[model samples]
Target: MYFIGELEGSSPDLKISLYKWNAKFFVKFETADLEQVYKISEMDVSEAEVRAMVTEEFIQKIIQRFKEMYEDLGELMGDY
Candidate 1:
């Protein structure tokens, strides 16, 4: 897969990347040093389409995933 571009967020380091892999598009969002990827089909897909797919709910899911990962790590480390 190759990178199409990145979307800048409110935070300087927080960003979203759009990638093209064959006939599909991949979205990469990074938060709290964790990265999450989302995939969408390429049917009639355009830059705007890919950009539009990232809903507020989806972003929240990304954040939740990060939190879950952190918790999992803490558990593994016996951090309570």
Candidate 2:
């Protein structure tokens, strides 16, 4: 499965591609203007395993941060 996420930063808008295969998730972040990319890997496991790997609080915090970033990007682009 594949999913796309948006990243907002001072530099530029970014699109993140996430691929899930073979019980792992590969996340690739792509910068729209600079044509640069970075990737990180996360192990794929059951919901319980994921919860054990990362705390719910941490996950929620990260999600909130990203959502803010995305919203900021939309505002900067006047597309919100």
Candidate 3:
């Protein structure tokens, strides 16, 4: 199964995709020029832990990194 969501922030808008395979869930972020992916492990952790784990600050950092990488790739590919 797959799901897609949009994440809006002050800097840039991000599109996040979720994929479920074999009971595990994976997340991918997409931008015009690049894609970034991550995996969420199904462990025996509390809901609070999960909430605390993925904070807004962390997500923003991830988005920024992905965007930077994407821009770099575009430069390398002469897509400017």
Best by lDDT: 1
Q: Who wins the TM-score comparison?
A: 1
| lDDT (tens digit, per residue) of candidate 3 on 2-26 | 5533333323566655555545455
Residue 13 accuracy (lDDT) in model 1: 44
TM-score of each: 0.73, 0.33, 0.58
Give the residue spans of candidate 1 off by over 4 A: 8-10
Whole-model lDDT values for every prediction: 0.77, 0.46, 0.60
> Total clashes, candidate 2?
0
Span of 10 residues, lowest total lDDT, candidate 3: 3-12
Candidate 1 residues 1-80, lDDT tens each?
98988764425545778899978899888765667787887897787887877777777777677889878888988954
RMSD vs true structure, all candidates: 2.7, 10.1, 4.0
lDDT (C-alpha) at residue 14 in model 2: 41
